[model samples]
Target chain A: MDLTFTPDEQAFRDEVRTWLSENAPSEPLPSGDTADGFALHLEWERKLFDARWSVVSWPREYGGREATLMEWLIFEEEYWLAGAPNRVTQNGIFLLAPTVFEFGTAEQQDRILPRMAAAEELWCQGWSEPDAGSDLAAIKSRAERDDDAGGWRIYGQKTWTTRGAFCDKLFGLFRTDPDAERHRGMTYLLVDLDAEGVTVRGVDRLDGDEGFAEVFFDGAFVPDADVLGGVNQGWSVAMSTTGSERGLTLRSPGRFMATAHRLVDLHRRCREEAAPDLRDAVARAWIQAEAYRWYTFATVTRMVDGHQPGAESSLNKIFWSELDVDMHRTALDLLGSGAELDEGAEGATDAGLWMKGYQFALSGPIYAGTNEIQRNIAAERVLGLPRK
Target chain B: MRFAFDDDQIDLRDAVRGLLADTCPPETVRTAWSNSTGRSDAAWGALADMGVVSMALPVDAGGLGLGALDWVLVLEETGRVALPEPVVETAVVGAPLLHALGCDVPAPPASIATLLDSGASLYADTAECLVVLDGDALRMVDPSTARLTAEVSVDRSRRLFAVEMAAGAGTVVATGPQARDAVAAARDRGALAAAAQLIGLAERMLATTVEYVSVRHQFGKPVGAQQALKHKLADVAVAIEFARPLVYRAAWSLDAGDPDSAVHVSMAKSQASDAAELAARHALQCHGAIGYSYECDLHLFMKRAWCLARSWGDARSHRDRVAAAVVDA
Candidate 1:
């Protein structure tokens, strides 16, 4: 195996590194899930889209360079290392776009991707409902045929939608056939939050940011052209989206590598106060982060050879989710008494980023098919263990 | 960049693995513990015949001229079978020392008393020469001339011994800064080799555990059906999967002579050690009572994992090295 990158890939990395260093925002943008922060984040998104860095893996016709997966990973590494603003449009770029590229009609691709890439039409996923937290199939959201209008009328609520209060539209599943099985007869729909009879109520997260929204629908209309993968096939399509997003497809190791680097910096700063055990823990966290980078390289190697990542992605999710928690926890420990300080406190360190990240990482195990479900999938699917 | 083994490396690994499967099974390993000499002639001869004993040396030295990248997988195979042969000591650590020093060290069954990993050298009593890195100088002593005291290892297949030799010993083959650098690199090689082996040992143990849990019945169902147990095994699988790529990258780093090779090696060793230790702990736990018994084959792999997990810079030591490099740098 060749672990060294080719000269061409190296050149690509250098270019990304130089470009990000020069163009990335001088100051960190506010949390993108908040309304004002989202407006500022959209400005950053506009610049990225103008430079065609919005979606490096997509086709050039869609404002992308069509870079290889390896290049995509390099871009991610540079982006995170530069401390670039969060992509407020990730739900559209990462989650919805893959399925769109796979299942959207030519008209849909032409009309949707470009604007979405430009961040002109913000998008968020409408996956979770109050009743369907873990059992996503238990969603009771319904859609009815509106024959005269040539569209579908949607009904029900989607709660805990990240940045839903700020997003212009959404993509989620809605039951289209009442008589069909629980998993079947559902259709994946892209709906506009601004449409008539729709309500978006912002909810405060643990960090006190209104980063979540509960979208309520009463006869909100979505045209037939918005249906993805086809009617009654939402289960398989949604599964494919969530499966990859939970793995290396979305959460590139670059982000964690940056976090790990920051963690090392934190340790270096706190060396005097850090104990021998804390030093070891910091080293262990950094090592785990580096290990994850190599792990991703190996995985990307297989994928480049045309191998699909299957149940093994469950292994990936289980690993990085916990690694994220550990890395953040180690940082909090290094902060000691100072860690209790919230953001903007008189003497808060690292601007309370580690504390913010620790809170966010807590949700990592709970969201995207909780680690419990992911473990079960690993046992049943990868290990061939009996499913009870 | 490609991060996978090519066909040649994969073929070489599979070949050695197949040979060991036949020549060095659990019964053969058991024999090494009670045999007249700890050395396994059949396995060592077969490996030497295939050029594996000298794989890490230069081609001019009558060796395969392979780098850590090519030989690391084969070492992992040795770990898979828990082969009683001193492949790591002789091939990984010794052959290179001899080749670099330009010494005509006696044939295949050499041993080392290295400060890097071993306080006691393995197979030293049966070795033709017991080599030691005496600071900036490399020295070797005829095992017959040296006073060798046998030591009891938790894993009996590993025949460790304390070697005591006179000041001058037999010869000082190499000296000064070059020797010092070579020894340091050799230390990393030793640790990297152990890391690869730990991956193999963990995988084998996990596989055996998986097989046992799938079949062993309890409370009117297969014991593996329990969610709690399945999650534990799943975690073991996760740890092993993540640890392996680190071993591979570390081997690549060593072959490239990267400045960060030591850091990479430490990362690999720490992760692999944790993976193997986790496997050893949970494999026995999942297998229940029988796994602890001598009659069960799980102990054979489990005990080897226990010894090897800390053999080459236990997880904490390695992690501390990593911490110093990254934290201080």
Candidate 2:
């Protein structure tokens, strides 16, 4: 039960810290929701790829350092501490790339992983639909074989597609067999956004950012080579993506730790005028963040020891998503009425970063399977409660 | 870095859990509730024979020099059964405190209660020695030297006593900065031990409630099948799972002697207290009428959780410490 980093880990941490200190952006990049902002983020990804800092845990052939899980965690910590921009390629690199590595053919891996790592072809998730959000198995999106054209034709609407508008590609679950059961009929497909009959309409989030969109597929054709894993086995293949989304890849504890430290700094600056309740809230946020950090450490240890995470990922999702919301809420409380001010408004702090973050945090519980669904999973699978 | 117990620690946990499963079940705890001292000599002797009483004492002091992390699982198992023993106070905190203060007293299998400025002490009457904290110094007083007034705790299994120490009584084991550090270490480790116990208690309470809800029928179905009750219990399970890593991390920090160990300890204690409190509320409510009765075993753990939640350091006090470190820097 040791918490101290080994000398090798410390050395790796130093290397990461040095590189981030030198190469990290001096100011926040534009919002990735915007075209210009997307380009800027792509440039940043190129910088990381050039330095082999984009995906440290992946093998070198896939443009990574093949770093250990501990080293990957150290990289994340340094990445957040340096105030680096959020990974613009996370959807491709973290979510889809792992599935590709696991189930993609060698040709697919060779062609897709490097581009995904370099952020040359950005990706978005296509799981939830207008009809199927929490009840993902109810997806009615259909894909029929186009034997002459050599693949399948997809037709459905996928709503709440994060990065849908800007991303060049998507990996989604399409019902391949209309006669099969709910989970059995689905086939995971990789589709080009520029394909004929694919229309993406950006939806304005609460913060007025078009970070996600509603994607409509009208007879979009996809090749058979784009199918991930076996047809009708998409449920298991997609389950891997959901696992990564909730557990390791999508949200790292370092991001929350950095936010926690920022909140502490904000509290320290505002301590003179901060209310007692706000003080307690700030402290609670810090404690929760620290808990999350240690929890992730234990998780990484388990994963490194060859144990795959199970339903506990649901627990992690519920905790960190709620913690993110509460932490931002505390920040707003410390900011008082000024929290409502815009970026350059008089008396605004951190350019209203907390306000933007609070809005985003609210979406966390809704996405990656809603908290209600996660709780049900935790209840039934983790606790062995009887399913109704 | 490994964030798990080694083979030996795992063995110790299994051994203690097995012993408690046989010797100090809820039935034994309920039986001891009516006893004057609320002490079970048989269970204590069995645990002592397992070396838990001297598990944390230094080797030169005729005991294993095991650290808090090694004995944490043992303390957790004690909470699992609501064992009528001061193992946390005596072995987890007291023995280490004495050894740090250079006390050469034999590591007796009997419990040793600790007296802080907080007034109440655990097993004060049953313990052979009472390690009292006086400002920055520690005084190891013979329990017979202090005037003991028994007080009924919410948890009947825990026999609380208010002690009035005699003037110039006991031996001043250490003073000044060294005493201060030792006292601080004791408080942090004590709080951590209490945290682990609370986690274990919450886990047992949740499991017991889940088992009951599965069998107890209402409105033509088992109560566990109801969404409302299921969700409540699910939240309890999540809270317990989340608090676990915090407890383990706190134990690790204490063992590693991290500079921020105090803050980590406070966080662990605060989270564990909240988790246990949540479990107790939902467990009792889910069990309905039977959970409220003294005849039911659920009340034993519920009451134990309530007692331990306020012991070592309450949530409010620990939160203040967290605020000092995090908010105030």
Candidate 3:
């Protein structure tokens, strides 16, 4: 087995690197004082889409480069390394698009994909009800067929709907047969955000990033064509989409390396009176960052080799989430007494970006399935141990 | 970029597996550990005859000329059998370094090779060439060219040696910063090889534990059915799986002539070392008191894992090197 990129691949890398150097953002764009960062990120996404460099892994039929997995990984690495804005349409590009390509009807694909590619269609996940979190199979949201209406009426409460309040569309799951077994009755559907009887309420997080919300669907009508996969097959469709979210959202090692560089930058810009723990914390952060970089490289290599991500993806998730938390904690440790100050405090650099990152990291393991869940996955699936 | 072995590599790995299984039986390894030679010379010679020792040597040197990945393919088998011989020293270290040094390094025992510093110095009495360095001074000596001494080592599995060089007993193979660089590169390669073996040992240890837990009854149920112990086993499994790819990546990079091989080599080696030690320890814990006994055969893999983990370089040292390179990069 060889891990070295071919000369052609290296040339591709150079081209990507040069393009990013010229086009990527030099500073974070303003997102306004709101939960949705879509306004700023959507602009950045359009620039990438115009360049035809967005969604490298998608097939050529879907406005993608049709690149190899290795190339896709490299593109992401370079993109993040260039300090580009976070992907604003990832829910569409990474999750919904792939599912559509594999399982959605042609009509469905034709309708949603181009708008998604142009960043004109912002999407949000409508998974995880107040009662059903990790136990996703227990979703109680109801969707009933209406022959007269020529569509399904979705009546359910979906909580923890990330960015749902601002999204233009919702890709979610609901139980079509209440009497059926937990995993047997679910159906996946996509609904227009402006659909009647849909109410979105914000849930303010500790981090002050009000990105999550609860959505109550009262007789929300979704066209029959919006059903993803076959009727009872929604469970599997949801599973596939969830799997993509787990496996595809990882930031490449180069990005973490770039983050480490940022840490160095922060360290340098600090005043001489900065706490010494700040330096030590930065050093530790550097170590963890580099470690994750190597870890990511190894994982990417495995993925490029065509190994379907097994429980090992969970392991990567845990490592990265914990590392992110520790790194941000280190930032807080360095800020010392100043951490008590809110964002935009006088003399607070980058509006306390590190502190903001610290608070955001607290929700990482929780949102993308908890670390405990990941451990069980590793134990039960990867290790071939008997489930408890 | 493929991580799985091709057909030929799979065949070679299988052959190596058979050879190690036959030659380094637990009984045989323990016997050799207490023997005067502290190694199975017959087994070593047999391996050399079978091309294990000669696999990585250049085809022009009457050898197979296989690459670093091939060596990793075979080393995994070596760990499975807990072979007491220094195939790594003779095959990976001695042959390639000498090939690079442009010197015709002899076969082992006579070659007097130990890894950069994996195990205690073995066969000091008969070592014809001694490789050591201070700063940039690389001293290679024939026995008659240097004064030598021997020392008692705690690991009875291998003989230990000490030597004091005469004023001009050594000839510098390569000197100055370049030589240091070459040695550093060679040491990283050596560490990668050891890491591959550690992965093999960890795999075997986990396999053995799983098999035993499935059948061995405790409190009227199969031990594997227990959640507490299963979780521990799962932890070891995760560690092993995580380490394998890193080790494979390093070896593949080295084999493919990648410039970043050194950094990868250090990372893989450090992770593998930690995984192997954890796996071995957990295996013993799972095996209960019988695991402590020499008769159980688990100790064979455990001892090998323990030795290999600390050999070449320990985790902390490799981590420091990795840190320097990454920071500097």
Candidate 4:
């Protein structure tokens, strides 16, 4: 029942806080999904990688600090508090990396992790297709044996590939065994975006960022070395990644807590003119963040005690995704009509940060498996409800 | 940092849960509803025999001297059965208040009331020693010496009464700043107790509904197969999941005397209140007609949930308190 961090944990927190205070950029960078923004974010990622701060929980051989999960949480809190730029290589480092570590061979880990950590290569997720958005098992993407080339030739289209236009590679499910069942026979592969017959067309997102893309593959060649886990095992492997995406890795409490603090500060600044209702909303939003933080802590504690954290991540997804939306909504409401102004508009509040954030938070529920699907998963898996 | 109870605490909780399961079933609770004092004597006596009545009292007072963290789970089990007793008041808040007030009381339990908002106290009609918070003072009043009027509660098994204690009728156990702090702590414990109980009640409701939905058939299939109902109850389950940690954390915060313990309690109460109410709502909805009637066991837990959710600061009030703490720019 103890909540206080250990002395070593405190020391690590102090060290990171001091380093972040000195090294983190004073001004926020552009969105990492756009070309110019991606270029700037690449530099930030490089800076973090060089300092071994990008992925603190990974093994030291992979350019991480080999810190504990609690310390990793500490780093996130510091990173978000420092207002650090969003990780440009998050697709590789946060989501895919865990699966790779779990399923990848030593050869694959040695080849893939260091480069991804150092920003030498960037990756994007290619899960959602136009027809296979929520029903991911219905993926039509196919990769056939091209043993002559010692790899498979992939042919299909993946839509809503976030940051795909700028990424050099992608990791996704490919139908390898056509005879297998709906959830079987898929192969999780790391595909080179520069491979022949591969095309990435950037799609503009709500915040006017080309972070979304539709990737079309017409017999693109991927090496045999890129197959993650065994063939027909992609469903389980991809489930692990989605678990991370929907769980603690994709959205740590630190980010929301920082935003909540900002919301509180904003209310303080607007105290003279803020309505009582708005004040209450700001407070409510702040509690949601705090509650999520404690929820994560309790979860981490359980995992630390050696409990398998399946399905509960679905619970986390429902909570944080909605918390992000509600918190951002409260901020925009507090800002009133001025929230509509775009960035740099003369009358825009916080450089229209709340509006931009609101638009982005809108995607939280839609992406990483829609909250609807998550609720179903939670009901069936966590609550033992009937699937039918 | 360990965020879970140790083996001893778990053992204590399990023991309390088992004891209540034997001594305080719904039949006993129904019997208590018609009894004079509305107290389950056998259940209370068995619990006291287990030393739960004095578990939180100081060691010098011939008790276990446990903290709220240890008893948090026990209080939850009490709520699970909708235990027709003031275990929260008698043990959790009262023993601590009695200790703080330096009162030389008997080894038995007493119902303590601090809200004093509605001019009524729980179990005030027949409580021998009533710990009452009047203004800036904490008092140990004899309910028999004051004007007693019974107030019927929705959950009839647990009774309430309005007390008209004369000014300075009881011994002024503590006064000024000391009394203020103890009273505030007592109030926080009350809220935390309610929150833990609400969480337990929610779990009971969700389990009952889940069991009912699985067996009851409709439209040629089990009613639980409906996604609408599944998702509704899933949200209830999720609410309970999230609300529980807040209650546990609040218990820890109070046990450690954390400065923001009040805020933690508020968060717990707010979330737990919502979880229980949501659970009750979905349980009834999923149960269809049966849950509306008194025959269905779900109403027993739901009625207790309704009563607890509003007591010791409802969800809205607690959220406002949370807002004040976090939004005080």
Candidate 5:
């Protein structure tokens, strides 16, 4: 197997490297929780959209470069290496957009994709509910046909909706047939967040940020045109989103590699006081990151050759989630007493980025399907183990 | 960049796997432990007939002259069955070392073997020639010339010998800069081979444990149906899958002659070792009392994994090398 990039791929990387060096964000944008911060992130998305760098792998008609999978990976590496701001529109662009491309009608694609690319209609997922965290098929959210037979009326409460407070729309799963089987009755619907009878309450995360929210829909109207795939077939469509969440779309190896490099620098800076165990931990973090990078390369190659990722995505989810937590934990251990400092504290190192990241990393295993559930999926689907 | 094996490599892997499955089954491995030499001549002859012994030797030396990456899958297959042979030492390390040294050392038809450090060498009693890296020099000595004291290893299938070579007993194959490069390359290859083998060992152990748990009943049901055992096996599966890419990447780095090949090799070795150790612990726990016994086939792979985990370099030693590369850079 060849590890060196083709000359054309190298040229593409150089092009991306040059462009990022000249035009990447100079300062960090505000967190996309508050209205002001959301506006700032939307502007950043606009800038990327104008440069056709918002979604490089998407078709050109959807405001992307229609780049190859390898090129998309290269772009991610360059973007993270350049210290680019996090994509606030990821819930729509990375998660929902792929499903839409796979299952949405042409009209839906024409009406929804461009706005998502520009972050004009930011989106959040509505899959998880208070009562249906891991047992997703047990969701009690219901959607019934309106009296006029024009659309559906949705009534449900979706919790852990990341960026829900800032999002303009949501792609939610609602049971359309009450008497049908657990997975057969669900319908995937697109609902406007500002529509009548919709309310969002922010949930304060460990870092004291409203990064997610609980969205309440009280008879919210969604036209028949907003339904994705087909009625009562949402389970299969939503599986696409879960696949994207576990696959390369949600967490790119470049982010971990960049963090790993930073950890190495920290280890070097504190080499004198760092314990032997801490040194090994730092080295292990880098090695795991490198392994992840190579694994992603193999995955992207398979995808480029027109094969879909299967149970391996479950393996990827478990691996990256654990790696993220371990890497952050190691960094905190290296920080010692300084780890307790928040970003607002005076003379905080790295503005307490590691502490903040540790908080976020804690959510990795919990969100995008819990690691326990992912492990079950891997065991049952990948290892051919019997389910209880 | 492609990070997968080519068709020829895939065929090579399948062929090696088939041969091992047919000739080097666990029963054969167990029986070999009682043999005087503790080496399975049948399996060795099969591998030799397949030209695996000379796969890494230079073309000028009447060999295939394949690179390290090409031999990775074969080494992994050998590890899967815990093949009681010095293929890793002879084919992967010694032959490459002799080829690079351009010395008139005994070739593959006459088995060659090598060792990592000075502690013990594998198959030194059976090999015609033993290649050892002494400081910056690569030395070749007749096994009969050295004091070969048989030592028992944790894995019974492997027969280890402590070699005490007298001064000037070995012919210096290469010295100075050439010797240093050859020694470094051999170390990297050795580490990579060990790492690949560990992955295979983990994979086999995990698969065997999964199969055992599927049929073993507990609390009126199969234990594999329980979340605890399933999760443990899943964790082992995750570790094995992730460690594989690192081994492949390290092999690629070595073949490419990259400057950072040493770091990649160390990382692969460390990761593979950790994965194999985890697999061994969990495999035994899941298999219960039977896996701990020699009668059960699971102990064969589990013990081999334990021995291989500390063979080329233990996890800590490899991590220390990595620390030197990244932390001390």
Candidate 6:
């Protein structure tokens, strides 16, 4: 049950730590300074690339260290702990890289994996459509077979696409057969964002940051080789994709650890007298965030043991998503009247990170699949309970 | 890294469960509740003999060297039976903290200790030893040494004591910065274990309600079949399930031994408090007027659930802790 890395893993951690210490940007990597922090984060990714530290888990043939999952977690924890800005290439390196490694052909891997690791391409998730947040199989986006050009023409709208507006490519799901069941006839596609008939429009989130966007395809062309898995097997591919999202990138412990540290620091700076209720709430927040840390550790252990996350990822998803919201809510409660301050407002405590976190946290349960949906998945699939 | 209990730990769980089944049955709890004793020493002794009391103690301390995670397994069983013993207070809360602080108390079997909150610690009650925190310092002292009055608390499952201690002999188990860290760790671990027990108690309470409603007929049908009662019970089930991971993850984190152990433990405790109270309330409501009867065991676990949940850092405190650690800038 020990969370400590094995000695070899520890050494690997030491090596990576030394490298990050040497190369990590001394300045806070640009986030708010840039119109899109995603672009700024790419610079950090390039730093990781130059150091050969990017995508630690991918095979060396495709620019990865082929490190173990534990080492990967160590790298991530240290990356955030070092005050590096969010890794912009996460969607590409963590999600797409792994999926392509597993389900992508040799040719597909050769084409996508290196570019993703090198930050040559930026990727955005295209799973959730307007009608499909929880029930992803209800995705109505279509990808009809274009036998003439040996490719598929995709036509669909994907919302909640984080960084979609600036993404160089789209890894998403589309229904290939209009007459098939919800889960069937879907295909996973990798489409060039600049291709004809494609449009990416920014959407205003509660944080007022254009972090998310809507990617609409009137008739997007995708080579048949761009099919992540087999035609009509998109559901499984999409499941694996979303699963990777939930299980890997979204479940990154560093994000929460940084947030958790920021939370404690916030309380220290913001609280005048440390109201009792706020104190207790802060403690619970730390406890859950800590729980998430270990929960992720446990998940990584399972993966290390050659087992993939299934219903257990549901547990992780629920814990992390809800904790994210609860943490911010507590911060807001602690701040009381002070929470009314808008971003960049004068004398704003924590520089309105709490406000932004509050807004971001609102999406925690909604995105990646709602907490309700995760709970139902756990009850029905994990517990084998009768679906109500 | 493995979450499953090893073979011996599994056997320990099964054995404690068997003892609980044989000795602390629902009927036994009912009788004990009706009596002024609230618990049976004979059953507690059986637990002590089975080494359940010393399950979490270090092996070098003449007890099983099971980790905090292992104790959670026993806690679940203890919760399942709704045993009226001080497993949380003595084993989970008191002894481990004391032992960790180098207190050479006999390794369990009968370590009768109660958790004393800051308010209670200041008021010195009838407890022999009290767990107390003064600012960032935690002191374990014999309350009999200090004269203070015990205040009436909301829950009465275990004796709540108010103890007075002059900031000394607790051997700096942890102090200054480490003091809060140590207290937070113990509090979180205790809360997580207690919450797991509460989950077991909640499950039993909900089950009792379901069984009672199913068999007790009203308006020419079983009360359980009624949507009103069914929905209430369903909600209870959902709360229990929802809180399950918070407890499991908390305990798992503590057992897994992470730095954020304190935070995770609080979530479990906080979530358990909400879930257990809701389940108890709904279970009592579902039982109707009969659930209030002295002959029923529902109130025993219910009273214990409410009592344990509020003690050792209540839901509000835990929630605050979580927020502080999670939402800061």
Q: Score the docking of each candidate (DockQ).
A: 0.79, 0.74, 0.30, 0.71, 0.86, 0.20
lDDT of 2 by residue, A1-388 (tens): 6778999999999999999999999998877777788889889999999999999999999899999988888899889989999887998988998899999999999989988887788899999998898999999998999999999999999998887999999999999999998889899999999999899999977777788899999999999999999788999999999999888778888899999989999998888998998888888888888888888888888887899999889988998999999999889988888889865566679877788889889998988998888888888888777786
- What is the clash count for each candidate, in the order shown? 0, 0, 0, 0, 0, 30
Q: What is the C-alpha lDDT of each candidate?
A: 0.87, 0.87, 0.73, 0.86, 0.88, 0.72
Second chain TM-score, each model: 0.95, 0.96, 0.91, 0.96, 0.96, 0.85
Evaluated on CA atoms against the true complex, candidate 4 attains a DockQ of 0.71
The local distance difference test score of model 6 is 0.72
Candidate 3 vs. true structure, TM-score: 0.88
Residue B164, model 6: lDDT of 48
Interface RMSD measured for model 1: 0.9
Residue-wise C-alpha lDDT for candidate 6, range B108-219, written one tens digit per residue: 6344444444455311342356666665666665656654554554334344445445547443445576666656566666677778888888888877776777678877
lDDT of 2: 0.87
TM-score of each: 0.97, 0.97, 0.88, 0.98, 0.98, 0.77
Off by over 4 Å in 2: A344-346, B135-137
lDDT tens digits, residue span A45-129, model 1: 9999998899988999999998999999999999999999888898899889988998889999998999999999989899899
Q: lDDT per residue, candidate 2, B124-186, as tens digits? A: 887888988787667888899899998888888778888998777898998889888888788
Error of 3 at B160 (Å): 3.5
- Which residue pairs come into collision in candidate 1? none
**Across residues A18-67, which tens digit of lDDT does each residue of candidate 5 receive?**
88889887776666666687788788789899989999889999999888
Q: Tens-digit lDDT track for model 1 on B1-329?
A: 89999999999999999999888888887777678676565888888889898788777667788999999999899988888777777788877877777777433434444434677987777777677877677777777887788899888877788877787877887789878877777778888898889999998988888888888898988899899988999999999998998999988988888899999999999999999999999999999899889888788788888888888789998998887788878
In Å, residue A124's CA in model 3 sits off its true spot by 1.5
lDDT of 4 by residue, B1-329 (tens): 66778999999999988999898888888888889888887888888888888888888887788898988898999999899887877787777787877887566665554334345688776566887777787788887888877788888876777778788888888888998888778878888998999998999999889888888888988899899988898799778988888898899998898899899999899989999999999999999999999887888889899989998889889989988777882
lDDT of 4: 0.86
